[model samples]
Target: MSKIAFIFPGQGAQYVGMGKEIAMEHKSAQDIFEKANESLGFDIKKMCFEGPEEELVKTEYTQPAILTTSIAILSVIQQNGIEADITAGLSLGEYSALVYAGALKFEDAVKLVNKRGKYMQEAVPLGKGNMAAIIGLDRKEVDSIIKEAQDVGTVEGANYNCPGQIVISGEINAVEKACELAKEKGAKKAVLLPVSAPFHCSLLKPAGERLSEKMESLNIGSLQRKVISNVTGDYIANEKDIKDLLIKQVSKSVLWQDSIELMLDGGYDTFIEIGPGKTLTAFTKKTARKLKKKVKCYNVENTKTLNKLLTELG
Candidate 1:
C-alpha cells in the first residue's frame, strides 16, 4: 500500500498572489482566510492578495499570512477528500502542518505565529546576522566548516535542505568566514541568502526564549495525523512535546532532509506539497534523486495543480 504525505512550504515560498484562486473557487478556502483575519485582528487576506511585497515580507505579517494561505489551500484539498497519512513543513511551515494535523486550532496558530515572527525578527538586530546557502557540499563537510568558522564569530548549521544543499546562519562575520571556507573545502557555491535575520542558529535563542513564554498561554490539542518535527526529524505525538519542539525549532537546525528520510522509512512513497510555490518540491526532487528512489511528488498551489494532483492520485 502506498501512503501520501502532505508537506507545507516555508517563508521563501510566499508570493504576491498565492491562494486567491483557491479562495475564490472554494468556500472552504474562503472561510479559512476570513477566520484567520478575524483571529489575527487584521486583514491578512489583503496582505496576501494585494501585497506591497515589502510590507507583506515583514516577519510578523509574513508568518501568519503564509500559514493562513497554506491552510486555506489545505482546506480546499481536504474538502475534496484528499488527505495525507503524515504531514511535515519547513520552518514557519511547521505550524501549518500542525494545524492540518489537528494539533492546533487555526485561530490560535495564526496568533502564535504572528508572535513568533515578531520575536524572531526582534531577536537579532538588522544586518548584524546573516544566512547563506552552501550548495554541492555534503552535510558532514558543511557541519565541519561551520564548527571551524566559530572562531570568527557565532555560526551554526541552519537548514539541512537536501543531500548537497545546506543553509548556515550566524553573525555576519562568521557566516562570511564559513562561505569563504566552504568554497575552499570543495563546495560548488556558497552565497549569502537575502534574509534579514539569521534564523535557526544559536543567535536566535532569544527568540526561542520568548516563544516558549508565549507558547505557555496557548491551547494546543493532540493531533489526528502524524506530524514530523523540524528540531528532531521525528514524530511529535503529544501536546507537551509539540510545544517544546516549536520553541526549540526557533534556534535549532531544521532537519528537513532527515525528516523526509524518516517519512520514506515509514513507508510513504508519495509526497503532496499543498501550499504556495514549489520550493519543497524542488528539494524533494533533489533528495529523491540523491537517494536513487523513484518517488512521486506533486505540488498543488492552484486549482489547475489541485485538479491534476487529484486525478493523478486517483
Candidate 2:
C-alpha cells in the first residue's frame, strides 16, 4: 500500500546536457523535447544538450529549460509504465506538476513559463534584489531575523525548505543585513545564492501581476491526479483557485516543507523527483526526517537514473 508522488525541481537546477541521454535513447523523451522546441520557437534542445552556460542561466531561459527537461523525463517514466498517485513541484515546477495532473497542456505550459520567466526577470533591477540561505535556524528564528532586518531594507522569507533550512529574499541591502544578523544569532551558515532576481518575495509582486494577465488567455482543463500547491502546501481544493494561488505564489513564501508534510501524512511513501538535479529529492528526505517519517527518493535526469528506477519500481 505504498503510494507514490512525482515531484519536480524548480529554477537553479539546470546544467549542460540535462536531458541529452534520454532524448537520444527514448523516442518518447525525444518527442517531448521536440514538442518543446516547436512550442518555444527556439533551439532549447541545443541549449540543454550543449549549453553555452551563459544563455542557460538567464531567468527567461532557465524556467522553460528546466520544465522541458522535466517533462521529457516524465514521458520516459510513463512509457515504462511508472506513474505517481499525486504530484507537486517547487516554484516554477508547479506548472509541470499541473501538466502531469492533466490541468495544463505541455505546449501552453511552455509558452506560459516563457512569459513568466521574462516577467520575473524584469520585475527587479539586477544587483538590487538578493537571496540568501540561512542554514541551521528554525522558522521562528528566521522570521525574527527577517522582521529585524527590515529596518535595513525590505526582507522576507522566500522558501521554507525544511526544518533547519530557510531561504530569504528581498532588496539586496536588507537580505545582506539579514544574513549578518543570522550569523550573529548562531546560524551555521548564511550564504548568498547566485540567482538573477529576488523570487518568491514581495519584491516580485509585480511579476505575479503580469502573470495574471498572461494566464487570462490560457485555458485550464480537468485534473487527472491529485496535485498540491506551493502557495498553500495542501491539495488544491478547486481548479478555479489555481490561477489565484499561482499568482500569490510569486510573492509569497513557497511552502515546500508543508507540501511534503501533507503528502507524508497522506501516506505517500515513495517520491520520484522527475527533473534534472536532485534538489527536490534532498528537500523531501530532510522534511521526512523532521517528521519522523520514512520515505524513498529517486530522481531521473538521464538514462542511468531512469534504469535504476525501472529496476526498483518496475
Candidate 3:
C-alpha cells in the first residue's frame, strides 16, 4: 500500500516569485490568487510574484502570502488528480494543512492567518522576544537546558523540527542564554534565528487569545481528509477540536517531527512538500532516516517540480 502525505513549509521559507510559474500554467491556480485578492482586498498575487522582500517578509504579510501560494499550488495538484492520504505542516503552515483538509476554507484561512500574524507580532516587542535553533541536540536536553535558563527570561522549546534540531523561543536574554548554555552543553551548533517574535512559546499566549476571538467569527467545516495538528502531532480528533487546537497552536510547541513520525508509523510512504521551499522535505527525510523508515520525498514550488510530481504521481 502506498500512502501519501502532503506537508507544507512554514515561515522563513517564503521568497519572491514563489507561485508565479504555477499560476501562469494552471487556471485553477490563478483563480486561487484572484480569490485571495478579493477576500484580502489586496493583490497578494503581486506580492508573491513581485516582492520588494522588505514588505513581503513582514510577519503579517508572510503568513497570508505563504498560505495563498500553497493553496494555489494545491489547486494545481488537485487538477492533476494527485492527492494525499494525510497532511501536516509547520507553524504558520498549519493553516495550509487545514485548508487542504477542508477543515478550513481557503478564503477564511487567508483572512484568519492575516490577523493571526498581526496578533503574533504585537504579542511581543521586537527586541524583547527572540528565537534560536539548537542543532545536534535532543529535545529532552534542550528542555532541561532551557528550564535551567528560565531565570534569564521565559524561554522554551518552540519547534521540535527534526531529530536533532529544536527551535527555542522566548525573552531575548533567556533565549540568548539558552543558546550559550546549549553550546556549553556540547550541542553541535547553537545559533540565533532571525525572526520578529518568539512564537509558539508562552510569551505568545496573548496572541493565541487574540486569534481565538478571530476564529470564532469564521465558519469552519468538517475535515474531508486526515490532518495532523502541530500542537499534538497526531490526527485532529474532530471538527469541534479544530478551533481550540488552532488557538493553542499559537502558544504551543510545534511537534513537526512527531507529526511526520506518526505519519510514517501509520504507513505514509510518500511525502510531497506542496508549497514554497524544500525545508519540510529535508525535515521529513531526516525524520524518516531516524525512524529507519523508507520514503520518497518531493517539493513543488514551480512548474518543473510540478511536472516531475505529475509524471510520477499522475
Candidate 4:
C-alpha cells in the first residue's frame, strides 16, 4: 500500500513572512500562531510575519519561529484532511514531527525548542565554530574528509542529507579544512552555511545535556502515528524512547538519507513537507532520484502550493 509521509524542515528553513498567507486564510493556522504567542509570552507571529531578519535568524528566536510556522502550516494541512502515515523532521524539525504524531504537546514543544535553541547557541562561542555543505560527495567520502579534517580540529559530518550532499560541522578551522579537502577531493561545491552555530556535532554535546535535563520534566504522550527518528533513521517503537532520542539528536548526525530510505522501503511513496521553506522537499526529490525511487513530493507553506498539492493528491 502506498503511504504518505509528512516531513518537516529544521532551523535554517525559516524566513520572514513564512506561512503568512495560510495563517491569514485558515483560522486553524491563525490559532496556532496565536497559541504560540500566548505560550511564548511574545509575538512570534509578528517576527515571522514581519521579521527584521536579524531577529528571526537568531538561534534563540529561530527555533520557535520555525516551529510555530511549521505547526501552523501543519494545522492547515490537517484541517484539509491531509494526513501522514508516518512523520519525520530534520534537527529542530523533529519536535514538530513529534507534536504532529501526538507524542509531544505543541505548547511544551514550543517552549522546549526555545530553550533548545538557546542552549545550542551557548554551546559554542560566536565565530569559534562553523558548518559547511559538501556537494557531489557521498557520505563515505564526506566522512573521510571530516576524519581527515579532525587532524586539525574537531570536525564531523552533521547531516547526511542525501546521496551527494552532506553537512559537516565543528571548529571553524576544522570545518574550513574539511571544505578545502572536500573540494580537493573533486566535490562539486563546498560552501560554508550561514548558520549561527555548529549544530549536530560533539561541540554541541553540552547543549544536548542541557536539553535532556529539560526534557525530563516534560510529559510525553503516546504516539498517534509512527515518527522516524533522525539519530537512528528508524521508527521509534516506544514513546519511552522519545526523550532520549531527542536529546541524542542534538549532538548526533542527522541520518536524513537513511530516514527517507526507511520510509521509501516501507511503501511511503508520497511526501508532503509542512514547513516554511521547501528545503526538505528538495532533499526528498534528490534522495528519491538517487535511489531510483518514484515518489511524489510537495511542500505546503502557502495557499497556492497547498492548493496545488491538494489537487494532485486528490
The TM-score values for the models, in the order shown, are: 0.98, 0.99, 0.99, 0.98
Please give the CA lDDT of all the candidate structures. Answer: 0.91, 0.93, 0.92, 0.91
Per-residue CA lDDT of model 2 for 64-173, tens digit only, reads 99999999999989988998879999999999999999999999998889889999999999999999999999999999999999998889999998889999999999
Cα RMSD for candidates in order: 1.0, 0.8, 0.8, 1.0
By lDDT, highest first, what's the ranking?
A: 2, 3, 4, 1
Tens digit per residue, CA lDDT, model 1, 1-314: 66899999998788888899889999999999999999989999999988989988999999999999899999878877888979999999999999998889999999999999999999999989999999998988998999899999999999999899999999999999999999999999999999989999989999999998988877888789999999999998677788889999999999999989888777788999988898888888888787777788999899899899879875
Each model's number of backbone clashes?
0, 0, 0, 0
Q: List the residue pairs that clash in candidate 2.
A: none
> Stretches of candidate 1 above 4 Å error?
none
**Cα TM-score of candidate 2:** 0.99
Cα error, candidate 2, residue 264 (Å): 0.6
Instruction: Give candidate 3 misplaced runs (Cα > 4 Å).
Output: none
Per-residue lDDT of 150-197 in model 4, one digit per residue for the tens?
Answer: 999999889999889899999999999999999999999999998888
Displacement of residue 66 (Cα, Å) in model 3 is 0.3
Q: How far off is model 2, as Cα RMSD?
A: 0.8
Q: Quote the positional error of residue 62 for candidate 3 in Å.
A: 0.3
